[model samples]
Target: MTSSSRALLFLLACICWVPVTAGAGERPARIVIDPGHGGVKEGAKGPGALREKEVALQIAHRLRSRLEAAGGEVYLTRERDALVSLTERVEMTNDHGADLFISIHANSMPTPRMRARTEGVETYFLSASASGEAALAVADRENSEAPMSRAARGDSTLALILDDLVRTEAHADSSRLAYAIHPRLVARTRAADRGVQQAPFFVLSGVECPAVLVEVGYISHPEEGLKLGRADYQEKLAEAISEGVLAFLKDTRRRDAARPAQVAGSQTP
Candidate 1:
């Protein structure tokens, strides 16, 4: 069967069943999953009739399932085939006080005739500007022409004044989270292991927590696209991501616990 048909079948199967729930008194880690493109805006297209929106939604659902099964509190930016603005998506995560923000996407290349050999996992953290080609490509896809005021864009002097506040706070954790998960993803995919990097992706910029935009694999790569469309591959991909997230959370908690205690002892007489 064609990939789209297969994806539809998979989605139906998920919908038909009730998701397994977690045990009592378990405080699941809160996660916000953003399915890349939706509604009229089909992000990218590939061979075997793979649309970016379709794959993103499918992956987001699967990812949510994986995270929830591991006792994570998961929320999706878009549950169905509908358009959600970037600004709104960020606000949702921020408002919900989500622990992490993960925007799921599939990649497409400019050159259609480019060979199908390119395959890998690329994860991105927030940055002020793109330093390279991979960064540029991600930025270009995400920086859609949604209308925004000059102030919000940091085009005004006052906005620039608070830039440091904006910069120093959230993105540090985001970078650390990305670093933690990326290597695990590379190891699991066993594809081209493009290491973690920073870029000015709109999706990652506004959130006030650890955030990442995951380009799981190049859908334009014919061979990889076929693999991505399979249920087995999807399960493996979700499993790897889950493992990475769990490891990161555990390590972070331990590191936090190791810091020396501040005792207000021996006050001046």
Candidate 2:
């Protein structure tokens, strides 16, 4: 961005806040849920032949139902085991003017030992660089299926990312959204809290609203994999995710509602 454009964005950032309303409140929350990996990308398989793609779809469907029941207007990127490009997913979110965008997938490890030992729930919001090596690895594998657009890559990428973050205030909101949801997931599922991290997730790029990617559990984990394949467990996962999303939306509304008052108070000096 040029100096003028940067100045404009910075000025807007000083005055902007997007309030998230409840589905049954003033407006319904428009949510886009993406079930990652389908078609040729079968993703990982577990000891019982449980597939990541299948598990993700199951959870997505369950999540959709729960959100709709709660009055949120939810849209799935792919309703079934269908392949959806990363670009298409972003387009759908933009087209719907979504309040939130969440991509769901099962986690996996590269080796048997790693698979056996690693089991937990993880959540992520987008960033220019990853929080650490492990988070970067997760982002890399997930991004490998679809390379990011040229603008999202290359040496000038950091500048571009910062520009977008400043323009949208999405980075800050996305982090808050992740923090609100991660704990509920761990509490509801009784899964290890793998903790939240930020990474350069391709699918999360360019989303107009707060976006997050959730790694529900390790599909390669012997016990967790079996649990993931079960209907009851899938329901639990869906229930937890829906609760988190709704909670975040409500919290966003509360936070934004107070923001102007805080700003006005600060200006009184």
Candidate 3:
């Protein structure tokens, strides 16, 4: 996809969703966009010296722009290049009372010597424990950016607090967001569909809203790296994400409408 082609796709997607009538009472949706890695924390690297932080931030900005144009209130965890603690990022959104949290990232593998052909987007929700190799791979790369200390590795105090407070309301919502976005991206970009999974991402575990971490593509794969580095692909990535967020809002509204109203019995005599 070229830049012009990607822009056309985004324009078309926007036309499909932009409300035409009765837009009167609709509340503007809010979203928190977290661009993974920053400052000294150069996340995963690609074949051509592309940094995960750089691409993540670019995509995050693109996503923010799209959401804002669609009448959404989007907040960014970090606007400039600076190291932000994972705990702080989640807390920021919690404090802001945002509707959803999305962390953007690119994937990398350890076997740099032997390139395995893996390319796709994977969406994740918080889990107490990650299941198998997929979970392990995610942990390894995410951990690489911020190595865990002994204190950090210790008990489950943080997890317990977050599980009780943060992730409850939005786990299913985040999963649905993931489901909505990943396929659109795959279809539009012709990328592989890694599908959505649950993983205990430390960054997402502490958030209050429905939170998800999106691995946009495999930086480790040479071809994928080239594709992701292109502005065209990034725009497509942004547009697909925007569509998913819209879907989430639409579904939430529908669900709220379908729920029975609570009636008070003889409150006043």
Residue pair clashes in candidate 3: none
> How high is the lDDT of residue 62 in model 3?
96
lDDT per prediction?
0.74, 0.83, 0.79
What is candidate 1's lDDT per residue for 73-98, written digit by digit as tens?
89999999899988889899999898
Scored by lDDT, model 1 comes in at: 0.74
Candidate 3 local lDDT, 1-269, one digit each (tens): 99999999999866655531114686567789999989999888887779888999999999999888777778999998889988788789989888889999998776866346777778777766565678656855675544464247654864575566443657777778778778887887888888777766778766777778889988888898878788999999999988887877777777777998877894566
- What TM-score does candidate 2 get on C-alpha atoms? 0.83
Candidate 2 residue lDDT tens string, 83-198: 88888888989999998998998999999899889999999998877899999889888887765543456637755765667557777888888987899889988998999998
RMSD of each: 9.1, 12.2, 5.7
Residue 114 lDDT in candidate 3: 38
